[model samples]
Target: MDGRLIYLMGPSGSGKDSLIQAAREPLQALGCEVVRRVITRSAESVGEDAEGVSPAEFELRREEGGFSLSWRANGLAYGIPVEIDQWLRKGRHVLVNGSRGHLPVALERYPELVPVLLTVKDEVLRERLLRRGRESPEEIEARIRRNGLFVGDGSIGDRLIHRLDNSDDLAVTVNNLLSLLKLSVKPDQI
Candidate 1:
């Protein structure tokens, strides 16, 4: 199969959803497919293109081998549907908004997978998280703390990772992402 999997991972409030949306057209022009994840969190709770399922339901799905890959974080379970395997095997470039903690498993499963790690300044992260209003102040602080070690916990290294800073304008970040994927920017899209 000629398809490649791009695993996009980042901290909370790092503009992941926005980046994914913005990159869709350009990436697709280059024959890439971006997929929404199956998150345990309700769709109404966030802007991500995700389907929400109860924890129990998620567990059932996991046990029944419904997910090609799955991971849990911050008390929420996340999964990539098994349908993606077919897409990849069919030589469709597939991108998934993924979890950093599950990178090892993902890498093991797809050796050709590229891990795109998104990051932003600490202050910017704090400000964005606060603006998002999805968590309490204490919860935000806890999230920030967790994000601190996201880059250097030692599970993965920088060698194979393509890191991007999302602190500035999103257009700039999206352009960088396109370039990273070696996708030509369509003039009309610029």
Candidate 2:
């Protein structure tokens, strides 16, 4: 059996983090590993910021063969650890928070990769962004502008891909994803 790789990519305020957090436990209970990604930015307030490492450190790690896949997005670097390969080797699917730009490369090399594009109404996204209070209104606007980028827009990666909506309750969004991915779920009954 071939394993699968699930990627959740979206706009900044589309609730990707919230959806990931809500689904983490239930997904794990189903014998799945939601692969945590490493980033080059300070974790600060993004609850699931993974772990932070400097760009230099990330480069060194990359040279040492520490990452299965690493790429930059919005001026920040992110990577999936090589250990995840072990899970895939055994036909165990792994879910990850990933850059949408990686979709094309992933599709080419790892046929198992499944990209899940997330979207929300702009107003809803703006409200969530404001509530987070992590960015100034200007920054929020910039992010939203950046978020809508896609294939025809000369964006970094292919925009034609599987997608999921996150406009409903956070938990519902997660379950909807699980359903779409055909991933197993443990009975937390959420």
Candidate 3:
């Protein structure tokens, strides 16, 4: 059987990175491979375990068809290497940190993918974004507003979109994700 793709997406401060980090070992135990993205940013940047490349290099790779999925978001370019297709064909479940804006294209390519949306309460999101110190208060407010708009607008589509709340403990979110994965993917393999 072919493996399923777990496309995880969320607002900026929704703890997607943290959840992925925490769930790595458990997911591996269940034969799942969490993909590392290729991003147009410095490796020194404090974020997910993505491969940082220059804009020129990123464009070169994209043009060469090195990526199975790619998109630009938050002024940065992100790519999922084409190797994920091989992994899926080999029956290894794969998880990717995906973009909500790019979900339509992703679904078009992999219609059986499990789309997960990580969410946080407004106050919690504000506090988390403030702690990151990457954005001004005004910018944070705008992001929060945008997040609210997206969630309320039904732009992500309600079909098969599993929502996970990351307002409290990280463990809870990780557990929730694992449970969802177990159910969404092949339970016999797990």
> In TM-score terms, which candidate is top?
3
> Better model by TM-score, 2 or 3?
3
Candidate 2 yields a Cα-based lDDT of 0.75
- The top-ranked prediction according to lDDT is 3
What TM-score does structure 2 among the candidates reach?
0.84
Question: Residues 13-43, candidate 1, lDDT per residue (tens digit)?
Answer: 9999999999899988877888878888798
* C-alpha lDDT of all candidate models, in order: 0.84, 0.75, 0.90
The full ranking of all candidates by TM-score, starting with the best, is 3, 1, 2
lDDT of 3 by residue, 36-151 (tens): 99999986684889999999999999999999999999899999999999999999989999999899999989888988999999999999999989999999999899778656
TM-scores for candidates 1 onward, in order: 0.89, 0.84, 0.95
Off by over 4 Å in 3: 153-158
* Predictions: Cα RMSD each: 3.9, 4.5, 1.6
lDDT of 1: 0.84
lDDT of 3 at 66: 99
